[model samples]
Target: MFNWNLIGSIILPNIGGWAGAITTAGQMKNENGTAWYQTLEKPSWNPPNWLFGPAWTVLYCGMGFASYLVWRDCGGFTKKSILPLVLYGGQLVLNWTWTPVFFRLHQIGLALIHIFLLDAAAAACTASFIAVNKNTAYFMVPYLAWLCFATTLNYSIWQLNKDDGENYK
Candidate 1:
């Protein structure tokens, strides 16, 4: 009656989300809320700094639920399950690293590249998940949309401040 598998589907993706969030928090130990990010020449369309936390929370939960659906449909991590899950895991790592790449290291150009790859990986993950469950693939749509916005933002910031150098710290 406890429904451990059901709990796992909810908990597992949140764990992945938390891992990325915690790693980003650690990486941004000295950067978050500091002038470093605030001082950037962001685009006019850039959302306020306060918006990111909530946005990511929703996105992460959706991601977890989607992954769970795929995992359940695929009958766990068999050979059939490997590709989609691996792609999901890979994109998650890239997702976590982008914040540090941009905020901690102040490497806008490199961060742009990372995000582009992240976008691709996420898209592939979604496509792969479709074979397992339509809902799983649908769940990734918002994340992919967010990534498109983020990619544009990153590129704009990079272009805007390319001459500023890495003096952001």
Candidate 2:
């Protein structure tokens, strides 16, 4: 018998992650010739543009699997599961919103702030997951590490271009 619930639980976060990626990709297409993201002054340590999709794909899968573990351990949204799941959902929403704010709206500063909140929410989610399953919490560690890197990158971009009026461009 196929475990549909397990499959769905894993797919849910990937859907949200890919939806955001697709939406941001569409927005990038509207940039005519000079892509706004490429024009930004990123940090020297920033990864190449081509790397983001693959990196995000892996992160999303890990996060989705982590959520499934949590759900499985707590018996699918029982009272014991409520807090961690809510934290997970909240961080997911924050995760989805960051791309649009940074890429579409060109609000680098706002995106930095948003990512800070996401970092906190993800940390809380990981802690809650640890209570449910230590192995599940391990899955979130990479995502958390990536988020830290991303936050530093965002802050760097914001600082590097704060006076350039690139946010408006």
Candidate 3:
């Protein structure tokens, strides 16, 4: 059996993440590694711009796969499935919102808040996924780790730029 629903489950979250990236590409292109970001006071440890695309691609794939496992184990849309799915969806929305908040709106402080909430949501989603399947839960670990690192980066950016008064505000 092809299991089209299972296929959809595996594909949709990745697609959503990809689409979100595409939709925000213009802002990212404008802000990333450009004079604006370069002018900002950032930590020396901040990742090079080249790393983000590949890292996000892997993370998005993991998200989709993890969601698929939860969907498969819980047999879709039932009471057992709702919590994990909801948590997954919630974190996805938060994930999608971060780029725009940071890049487009140029709100580093708000972006830091969003990323922290995103980290919390992702952690909760992972825990819920564990109740359904351990492998699925494991799949989210790297994403969670990345979010933790990203949160630190975001916080550092906000702190470093807080006195810039003219740029961020």
TM-score (all chains, Cα) for each model = 0.85, 0.93, 0.87
Kindly list the per-residue Cα lDDT of model 2 for residues 60-167, writing each as its tens digit: 888888888989999998999999999999999999889988887889989988999999999999999989999986689999999999999999999989989746
For candidate 3, the 10 contiguous residues with the lowest summed lDDT are: 27-36
lDDT of 3 by residue, 1-169 (tens): 7978766766776676677667556654553445455567889999987788779878887888889888888887889999999999999999988887887677898898889899999999999998889998567999999999999998888888999985464
Clash list (residue pairs), candidate 3: none
The 10-residue segment of model 2 with minimum total lDDT is 26-35
Candidate 3: C-alpha RMSD to true structure equals: 2.5
Q: Relative to the unseen true structure, what is the C-alpha lDDT of residue 52 in candidate 2, on a scale of 0 to 100?
A: 89
- Model 1's number of clashes is 0
lDDT, model 2: 0.86
Steric clashes per prediction: 0, 0, 0
Give the runs in model 2 whose Cα sits over 4 Å from its true position.
26-32
- lDDT, model 3, position 59: 85
